[model samples]
Target chain A: MSLLRKGQQWGTFACVWHIFDATWQDPFRSAHLIKKYLMGLYKPIYHPLNQCGDHVIVINSKEIALRGDQWQKRVYFHHTGYHGGATWTLAWELHSKDPTMIMKKAIYSAMDGTLQRRFTMQRLHIFPDDNVPKEILENVSNQIKQLRPVPNRLHEIPQEERDKIPRLIQYPSDYQLK
Target chain B: MAALYRVLNYLGKNVVLTAQNRNISLSAVTRIKEIIQKKEGNTLTFEAVIKPDPYEGRFLKPKNGACAICSSGLDIKHTDVLILSQFVTSEGNILPRRITGLCETQQKRISSLILMAQYAGLMLRRSPKGGLLHPLQKRKWKKFNSYYDEKTIKARYK
Candidate 1:
């Protein structure tokens, strides 16, 4: 095979490392996206029995955003295989106890239940913050686009830009300035 | 009858005397007189001239007298702090409908969006004065990033 064909073959089979930044992203929605990559469904040769899945490195998992009071509303249930061992934890409480747990569980539940599920999960990595190990960081070759644009805080905006934005309302005459 | 007539006459005289006392002021004081006085010398005087707003004509007024927000037809989200901040006072209260010129539905929607933005920490800078901290500096659940769905807003702005 020519050098070009050889390189193409290697690329198709290579377990590429993909990085996803979870800051301001909804974990549940992003789980489906991340699952696609982890399962290597993006590959043309993807098959249920194929060992073609890639590794996904999720960073800033602690900064994940949940929609509309889900932090206090959503509950995670756990059982210890014994009588009266059931426990339920709110989303925010679980996050506080383990920042990466929510993101991990989100992606874990997003995939189908199969014998390969455990092995597939082994390929996924999550970090509470952006402080990934240098060895793992160096292996990452692709960045997964964020599901939504990270909203900017008002205070983070520069004063000049704030002034340049067009005014929508003008105070009427005789209006006292607050 | 004689004593009642005497009491009535005494009350009438006292009322006239009090009215005379109340009228002893040099002149009536008003906001317009105060502003004119400050502009001129120490002597207060009334001026009927219309005061021009510094931001007059800076914004695009709605055609046919429609509300500014209604005419624009912008789907504003909570994260749109720049647009949201325009509807709020410097002290962080929503401007009244009379001044905002927004319709009832739009006013309600904007106020709700402002509240959501404030709670989500998107409008932290515009929050009321009192040692307000950044989102990262806030306590436990609040310190973590959170976002709200505009659909969850109780006020429907259709």
Candidate 2:
């Protein structure tokens, strides 16, 4: 009952701005959300041809997750249309080089193959971190909830709680976790 | 016309060559004789002087100096002016300059800015009710009902 209280308004609005925090969420899930929001599928006024999609701002794209084994097994293929131009890159390596590349590609391929797909894709904004411009921040009217809550960093946990957790063995007296 | 030009050309050449000699041709003196002689091949006739196109040289200046939105010192990214403006339709179609009262450049800027705003989560793009067609274009039940009435229904059933 409490979860239903925060349900988004589903009415057809002329314009809406949405923000998403990509931290620790699956990149595929984030891409799906971005595609859905960009096409404005959640609204009643959504039409395949109509440019009724809303804009979505995605921050912390660098921290997006991949399902187990995908990071090592997934390979992105590319060719430069020249001799010996074919290249294969592992997912983790590609993500490290350009944090937004995977998500961008996911959303790009997910959209319908129409001329308007290019235009709709323009509505997705991705940032590697939380540092969005002040002007863009001011315009964000809504937040798209993440599929999972962000895990707390070790430093954020209370000192007493850390000490209370039982361990099979203790490190040397000189050892420092930091 | 060629003969006349030839005559004028020869006469000038002869005059330059025979400046000391006054032995000029009688045909050259008579203007009627020059007009009567016709050249064997095509003779150059009327050549009309063409006027240059008026609009060709003119550059269009936007009505009040620079673009309307730019002149007002409103930064598209920082300000909500574009989002607040009614220049864009619910389906993200930009209104024409006539309705928006903006110059051509500004209209383009507004459109791009609106798109940017939409992507940045600052604005919404929505479609009008019942798509682009007007309500009047929709067929009235009485008008369209006849097509699907008894005769057609019977034909399909049969």
| lDDT tens digits by residue: candidate 1, B74-106 | 899999999999988766677898878788888
What is the DockQ for all candidates, taken in turn? 0.35, 0.00
The model with the greatest TM-score is 1
Q: State which candidate has the highest DockQ.
A: 1
Worst 10 residues of 2 chain A by lDDT: A169-178
lDDT (10s digit) by residue, model 1, range A1-178:
9999898889889999999999999999999999999999998899999999999999999889998778888999999999999999999899999999999999999999999999999999999989999999999999999999999988889988887777777666445554
Q: What share of the true interface contacts does candidate 1 keep?
A: 0.58
Regions of candidate 2 where Cα sits further than 4 Å from its true position: A1-11, A153-156, A162-178, B1-158
Q: Any runs in candidate 1 off by more than 4 Å, and if so which?
A: A1-8, B1-54, B125-137
User: Model 1 residue A112 lDDT?
Assistant: 92
Give per-residue CA lDDT, model 2, range A1-178, as digits (tens). 4545435443365567899998768777667777888998887767898778988998988777665346667799999999999999987778878888987888898887898999998888889889999998898889998986553423235666544432212222221111
TM for candidate 2 is 0.45
Error of 2 at B104 (Å): 76
| lDDT tens per residue, model 2, B1-158 | 99999999999998887664533233323211111234556863322222332222332233356544544554433124223334555445656665455656656666665544333223444435633322123221211100001121111211
